[model samples]
Target: VPPGEFIPVAERFGIASRLDRWIIRTALSRHGAALRSGALTLGFNLSAQTLSDPQLWDFVDNVIEETGAPHSGIGFEITETAAVTNFDAAEQFVRKARERRCRVSLDDFGAGMSSFEYLRRFPVDTIKIDGSFIEHITQSRFDREIVLAITSIARSLGCDVVGEKIEQQDTLAMLSDMGVAFGQGFLLHRPEPLERIV
Candidate 1:
């Protein structure tokens, strides 16, 4: 199932945090050497329920310590919507995560009404533009404008911009021209099994 469909269900059922914990443990453990050596950086998308879980980082730090990945070379991707759900908690979470040397990213950035609010407050290192805007960016003037605006705002705030769902070469070129620091989609790499990736 697509994460958009299942994540909400997992969140409602209080299983999201457990799932997140499992992902963190598995990722750090399996990729410890590369992460510790700063050869690779792994990013995990966290659910809103997981963000509110007070024990989340302690668990993460323990796993990091056990793996001996100091930089952790791990970044947490929290959707803008999730960060807004519990503002204070989210703020504290971002601060603590960064303090521990893990990078934080605000995912699906323009999808939220309070995108600017989070940018002003949260010390996230990056903001990922919503895929909705990238889907037809090559054809839509409006999409291009929005992407430009987001990239400009993010740059002004000292946060890097990441463009998602970049499928075509035109889209990739456009995003690079617009100053997006990263791109992720089937165009760059199709999803592969963990065994193959590791």
Candidate 2:
């Protein structure tokens, strides 16, 4: 899992730019080794602060070179709020990442009212349907509709959709019925040490 506290530290220290580089370098070092062993690609969560940095591209270039990891082997996950707040810069970053063959995903989709608009603006390759909606799929028709809407939009945009926080077998079956392309949750796989995963 991505370190949850790193972004807060970067913001508090006013060195978010440097922290972004450090994240890329540190994450790639471990993830690159995994790639070499033919493991699944690693995903990194991008902080909103990092998304706005003009120098982020430079950092990305340096890390990619240092790690010798294919752009396709790296996926960046940015929250919906972050993407909308930094829409223009995020769009450019997404475009550039795509050019480098890196995949971009809109994380926490459907958290706010403007998610669809954000999706229209950014060319993301994946949309991770927020857990709030996924968790209550059976309890509320509205939640199911929201997920369905996201699924339809993703399909139309030619993007894969991943459902998160799937805790029950029935929930997994519901999501499968909706034809979600991927999913992640304890029910599917829990986090284990790297050595244990293999």
Q: What is the lDDT of residue 69 in candidate 1?
A: 74
- The lDDT values for all models are 0.87, 0.83
Local accuracy of candidate 2 as per-residue lDDT tens digits, 46-81:
777788988888887887788877778888898876
lDDT of 1 by residue, 137-179 (tens): 9999999999999898888888888899989999999888888
Task: List candidate 1 segments past 4 Å from native.
Answer: none
How far in Å is the alpha carbon of 41 misplaced in model 2?
Answer: 0.6
Q: List the residue pairs that clash in candidate 2.
A: none
lDDT of 1: 0.87
lDDT of 2 at 141: 98
Scored by TM-score, the top model is 1
Clashing pairs in 1: none
